[model samples]
Target: MKRIIAKQEHCMGCGLCEVGCAVQHSKSKDPIKAYNHEYPKPISRIRLELNKPVSFAIQCRHCENAPCVVACLTGAMTRDEETGFVKHNPEKCMGCWTCIMVCPYGAIKADVSGKIVAKCDACTELSVPVCVASCPNGALECKEVTS
Candidate 1:
């Protein structure tokens, strides 16, 4: 399967990925409008670890044995067999936050206003996720992996 990988050596702590993610997820998909008009606002699915000597962006690992999947009672989190991407269905979500508690990577986030938990779905709707495209450095890349 192809997945997004982080090359920490190349990361310079630039936050363009966050901006790009917010804009892409925004209702208007516009930088200006997203910052000014979007209600409930958009958050970057990718989060950066700023610890000294090593800073890299992290997102959902989509684990083979996903604890989040097991923890979800509302059937909102499910993995797609064809694409190997774990996706969230907001409609089915009851916002119980059970998934958030079990995710070991701390990848899940609460979208209180949206009434759904958020995690990286790898931007399945796009050819390349906004975070990967907007990265100023080559720290982030999408490559095939053998698992």
Candidate 2:
């Protein structure tokens, strides 16, 4: 399965991935409209892991031995064998923080409302993830990784 990989050294901290991701998830799917929307603004599945000199976009690793899936009591978190992507079902989620606590990379995060957990789904619904597509520096790439 293909996963988003980052070239940390090439990252310029431009943050276009965040913008694109949010817009893609928003109601209108328009940058301007999503930014200025009154309610339920879009949120990003991608996050820039910044630390002065080293910066990279971080998202779900979709681990082969996913701790998130093991920790989730409600069975909302699952690993798809065919796609090798860890899937999260918000409706089945009980807003439990088990997944967050066990994720080594701290990829999973709670929303502002705290009603559901969010993480990179690899944009399975689309051909390419917004973050990878919006990267101006070509720092983000989707490739298959061996467990």
Give a tens-digit lDDT track for model 2, residues 33-141.
Answer: 9889636666888889888689999888899999999989999999999999999998899997889999999888886467888888888888888899999999999
Estimated TM-score for each candidate: 0.94, 0.93
Span of 10 residues, lowest total lDDT, candidate 2? 37-46
Model 2, residue 43: distance off in Å is 1.5
lDDT values of the candidates? 0.85, 0.88
Lowest lDDT sum, 10 consecutive residues, model 1, at 110-119
Model 1's alpha-carbon lDDT is 0.85
In model 1, state the lDDT of residue 142.
Answer: 88
